[model samples]
Target: MKRSSPANLGAEKGQKQPTMEEDKVRSLFNSKIWDPEFQDTLKNEIAMSKPYNWGTIRDLIDDDLLRKVRKEIETEIHFTNKETDIYKVNQSGDLANLSGLDWNDLSRLPSLCRLREILYSEVYRDVISHVSGAGTLSGSKMDMSINTYTKGCHLLTHDDVIGSRRVSFILYLPEPGKRWKDHYGGGLRLFPSIVANVPHSDHSAKLVPQFNQIAFFKVQPGFSFHDVEEVHVNKHRLSIQGWYHIPQEGEKGYIPGEEAEWVKTNTSTLAQLESNVLQDYEFPKNERNILPYHQIRHFDELLAAQTSEHEATESSVDLSLLSEGELKYLAEFISPHHLTSAGIHKLQSQFVTKSQLQIDDFLNDTKSEVLKKLIKTDELQKECPYESVNVEAPWKTALPPHKWRYLYIDGKSHENFQTEQDILNSLNNEEMPNYNLLSKTLDPVKNNTETELISVATFLESTAFKKFLALVTLLSPLSEQVLIRRFRPGKDFTLATQINKNDLLERVKGFVEAVLEGTLCLTPTDGWESGEVGGYELYMDNQDDDDEANTDIKDAAVYRSDDTGDSVLINKPPSWNSFNLVLRDESVLQFVKYVSWAAKSSRWDITAQWDVKTVDDDSENDAE
Candidate 1:
């Protein structure tokens, strides 16, 4: 399941082999594997297993045979490096293709080919079914693959609910006779469910696997949530991961339309993604509420009248857009260079060329120094809260771990949103982001710790800030949302996702299916350049321009987002006092990668989004 795409890693459907005697099948496995007393004990353990029905077996295969099989794999197979939003590892091509190999191919990997036959053999399936109570599994539907999780490799949490998989198993092939310790990482972690479909953030159970042992569980939709812990040491955690599926057309337990009906119920979360169904369930929705009434009324008309429909260039700053008093207010937070004509002209050229811009030292030195010290002090002294009860009001946790989970200040408090109704109440009677109001009300002396944060946030929400943005992007903003966010090390991440353009399209007459987004990263730490420890913001092109779906994506719901791939448009790691601005459309999928537990500190940043209208450039084009 930690693959780039869905895989049916098995050989062709196996026909029932009535001629193969029970003795012959029994001889293929370890002498202890098929013992009725041993299986009965395993069955009882599985029935009482918490989280889900899962069990393990040691020395499942014959020792000499397995050793030969491992040797063949080493000599014959080639593993390819893969990185995705969810996982990273090196894996061989589907072992299912092993069954279809020509005579020449089979000769090269004879032991591997022979091992596959024994595993899919009908008698073996019966043995597995009996112990796990998985009634009548198909010997044909063997989906498996060979993979190795070396240093830094990992898989995130999710239920193994893709397609019609009946059971999931992992056979570890670490060095023979060696003990894999818990601290070495690469453990198989299982999470208990808060409810039937929702899992708790922390894992309650873990498996520190051993050589030649296989861990297995039934594929229970919503309940079987697990993840592979990242391997920390410079050693190989080689293993074979596979799945058993419902019977095919000719298999013994096959039923009419059984597979199709199963697929309807047990599809990937991705299949229903980008639709309103899943999004409506997302808590603390990414909704950009309107700015405060006073700010809008005081400056909306003047700002609107000042905005021209002309294209920007390396031209002089528009001093008329900001009055002398307004410019003075902005200068306190923004760098003097950014306020000058030369700075504006340089930004104009960058935006015009690539529709994006990145500016270091965007904030004035005094403000930057204050932020760096405040943030670094908090990271060093304050212990971040991990539980929901500990997360205070004003700052809330983004919910539904499958999509995202991070601490954020969204400028309003509705406590926790539990259902669609809760979201509706908030949306219908909208509460806008009022950093200015929060700054005015917060007790400066009592909350001296948060004073500078509020000051920075208030400035970001200022009308002059929007004017600067409009000048740079040559667009007009109708509504905006500002958030102060912290991606805590080891606990926070957002999956790859895109926004609904239709939502923006419905708001204004010329909405243009676009949003001008900005992030002012304030993380104060080092060693983030390589991205091995996660905590990077990435943007990817979702699909081809003509709408041809990516072939690599299948029903199993995984993506191979190699860092160097063409799909990646941007990858930005956490840094101090840097600002990035982009005018992005719906086609761009964006996310913050999971922060590793090994990271020095939290990834801190202030994010902003604007629903903007592209102005007419007809007059400016004529002048050019």
Candidate 2:
């Protein structure tokens, strides 16, 4: 680790310097004051505390000093949207960019620099150690200062507890004269959990800061649900926000090679973490469709006309596959504002029937509201029971995580549902006004070509694609969205369509062709029951069983394996690279009708059949 000189510590040197009194308070922060009285107070005052209001060293920096810093930042700073592996530079949500702003111009911002030092200081280490007692934070180094939230800027509620985050802290830097008003918005909001895994919005913790005040909290996993209220006022809510990473030598929390060791541990890959989240939504552990990696070989297999069939005993986990009761329960929890009595009446008719007579009607509607209600409710349900299918051909599970990922439309990939509004705004501001129509040009030959290309672009720009993008954004480690617009006269169009649909039919054909050309990456094996320790398999501990025999069932082995070979190979879960049926114009029309029907039916098994075009068989192949 590198060290900055004392002189480089900046303008707030006086405040950063601890006095004897400050030292005593620091000692208290370091101590384990876990007595019953203290514990109860903490619980009442802080633990179960609603809308917490704790801030640190509020007036650590003087106004004149801050003004100078703001001037320097305003002139010399050049903020761009912050980019990350999970989130891209949001065009609509993000406008100002000071991340690339040179720190040299920020010298006058004494409060900013001072906050950083204290955060990376011994004081912070002691405070966190006392609060969390989670040993010391470790892993990814926090190197940059992201100062990019302005009016209307907000971040939705999510735990900052990504792999190995030690502590989360924010420093305030609103304009000098005006108070950082709550109405001006952009205040930090924290949510209280109904249970360890479930959170309710009934109560909240808001942090509206004054100049130089800093707020810190340990990164509590599944808890610590926080978001930035959208700045309502016209002014920018400037803040020097950062994190105090786990110990690094020469730094306050430094431990010997501790950071590197933790990084090597690979607590959980981004993909695995995503899998865990999706698992929360009705996807059973073992039976979930675990697709292959996004490799060329798998791509080829998808293009062939073969199905995947592995011999293993079916799982017995009674997941809420399609229960109308479960759907009603979820409607209460995250219910859409547009709910209507008509929709409820519709749902009641089908849900109450539960009779096999309406099974066909139930499986015929796969509309947005229906899917949304079903999936969202399923998401609220923590455990996914095993499901069995009697369909023909290659049999596999369609695990949510395995299928959803960053999906690209036009040139952009959407990873979360929240991003669609931003995407539409970007398109309107940058190019098109409305996506319903296309901009026409006047060159007979060129015009025709451009018109077709624009249609493709328009299709990519469609609301469906935007919704698809949002759906995939929440899929996992590949959370970042990216877009690259290109016009392919004839050849480009074919390839784009093919690439957009990277599913079994396409992959199988591609694989078969490659095999004939002697480029097959084949590793054949008899599928194992519970896959080998490292292979793609589900290891489930019985969670719901209450009886003693069920307790044994909990320990009983439940595994679903893809291959049973002596050769050790890595197994990659599936990707929805080319599994988009919703993108088709016909699909969209049918989808709307299905949703309308679903609002009334509230039934889950809304199945539809489409002919999958195979490589050898140009004719459509059908199976349910």
Candidate 3:
């Protein structure tokens, strides 16, 4: 590749002083006025800058000297787009082990050493000291390589509020003497402050470089937002980027723990922390399905009782609820293709109607035989559907009364609950009749039976019941491919208040949105309404409830009759659980697929997967 020199458009010359140190400081570094005071002044001047605005001194390095350094780096260095980090790098040359590389390694590359010498010369030292207002002059290190942003390349806005970095600098390297034309692209665009803490959408300061120009800025967290304008032509716009970390010990103004102190004070959100360069690989492993600390402890305490293999064996069979015959019946009903319309109609009439379906009748049906066969073939039937437990030969869930209560019971702290009277008081609380009834259903304490019964009715009116309906839809025998688990009020749920009805409903909506975005393959057209659920037009009559109500269980199951399509248990199929498990283990694949599909540029593809309908008159024509 042909080497290019750093750009220095509209270079201004500063007079060299009599003393050698003064000469270097005056010409090689930015002027004293443009250091800290200039930054503060610019912060105030740029109304576009947010409250946390800061800028670096431009023209710090001599243009002639910088051009030479840029040429050397461009010719000698190698580059690779990390396939890992979002950035690219030349790791094997002078910048090898850059994060831990010593500053002295620049000697290996003569041009880089020369560049450093000019950067930290005595004159520059005074300028830096005056601008930074720091007493110490520690060794400066350059670790990154020249990056070329060509056609279609772009970076989003973000603050460089990472650990210990005090200042950031980039030296542009394009063809020397050739004006990096405005239309040719590749300009350093600086954001203007919008408020104290945010930046404007459009750029306020643009540095279009010639050869040997250098741009520097203070590393202001949460305020600095800049991007390199993408090059439209095939030409490369290269730049050497690096950071100046906080001063080391023995340097003036270097506090022993200042770096650590700053980091401790600026806490990142879980989302930002996961994006750290060093922590990216470990993030998914640590984050996926991560239960809160309390939930983990609760599970640990509950599991502590099973000390022996005998206890584990005893916990598998649930004779009281689902016996051998019931398991056999379940296996039959769960077949992917076995239950067609006729079987569905027969089963709904023979067993499901009147809510009089006995477990024996459900088990004896021919469809039940399908479920039985599945249970017999499968070796890993979990007890708590929410939890995975091991079984030896026949997969069964133990239905021991306390074990049942332990897994399904809803128990939370109540202020007054020490003795029998306390328990009675909790049952009598006007706010807790439903909870009291469920408590009675599990243990059926002799006292306060009437209040508990009334509480059961209250429970039926709750949103949790609706959530349970949705979960049952997921776990139904006909759709074993779909996995569902309840977000228990105080246990499985997070990110929202467990007991807040509105919050819980919002969570359900979010879950629906995520599934639609990720798994449901959609076919979209323009006429679709914003929240349309089904793929195409729905001939739903906007009549009274009586018109919509089904006369019986079979009627309710027939969601629509015009389309002879088998009533789909789900709107569409979700990604296989096995595939998701693989993805959870392999982050690289997950990221590639996720970025390709979930990125803003490809959001339309996701919308298409859900079969989003269009509102246009021709939308009906398109569906056909």
**Per-residue C-alpha lDDT of model 1 across residues 300-363, encoded as one tens digit per residue:** 3433443441224325656666779878988898889888867876887788699888988988
Candidate RMSDs in Å, in order, are: 4.5, 22.9, 23.3
Off by over 4 Å in 3: 1-60, 83-108, 125-145, 189-210, 268-517, 520-603, 607-624
lDDT of each: 0.72, 0.32, 0.33
Clashes of 1: 1
Cα lDDT tens digits for candidate 3, 1-624 = 001111111111121212335554456544544356675564454423333333344455666667766666667655443211021122223342233323345554555555555554445544444444434443432223356665534332344454555655677767776778887766767664433223433455676765556665665654565656545566777776655556556555567887778666643222232333223211011111122334223222222222132145532211222235533443442332213333333333432233111111212244333323332232123222322132111111111100010111122222211223433454455341124434444433322321232232233222232122112121111000111111111111101000101222222211221111122111112222331111111111211234432121111100122123232111221111110111011111111110111111111111101101111222222222
Q: Write down the worst ten-residue block by lDDT for model 2.
A: 489-498
- State the lDDT of candidate 2 residue by residue for 1-624, as single tens digits: 000100011121112232234444344332333244643444344443453322244554444555655665566556644211111112211112222234444344443443343444454455445554445642224322446465434443455543345566666777776787767767777766543323333225677877666666765544565656555556777666555456545444567866556544433222233334423321111111112234222222322212121012111111122135533433332223212333332332332242111111111122223434433343344222222122111112221211211111222211121223432443354331221233232343423322332333343333232222222211111111112221111001000000112233333421211000000011112221221111111111112223332121111101111122222112221111111111121111010000110011111211111212222222122111
Our model 3 lands, by Cα RMSD against the true structure, at 23.3
Which sequence of candidate numbers ranks them by lDDT, best first? 1, 3, 2
Better-scoring candidate (TM-score), 1 or 3 = 1
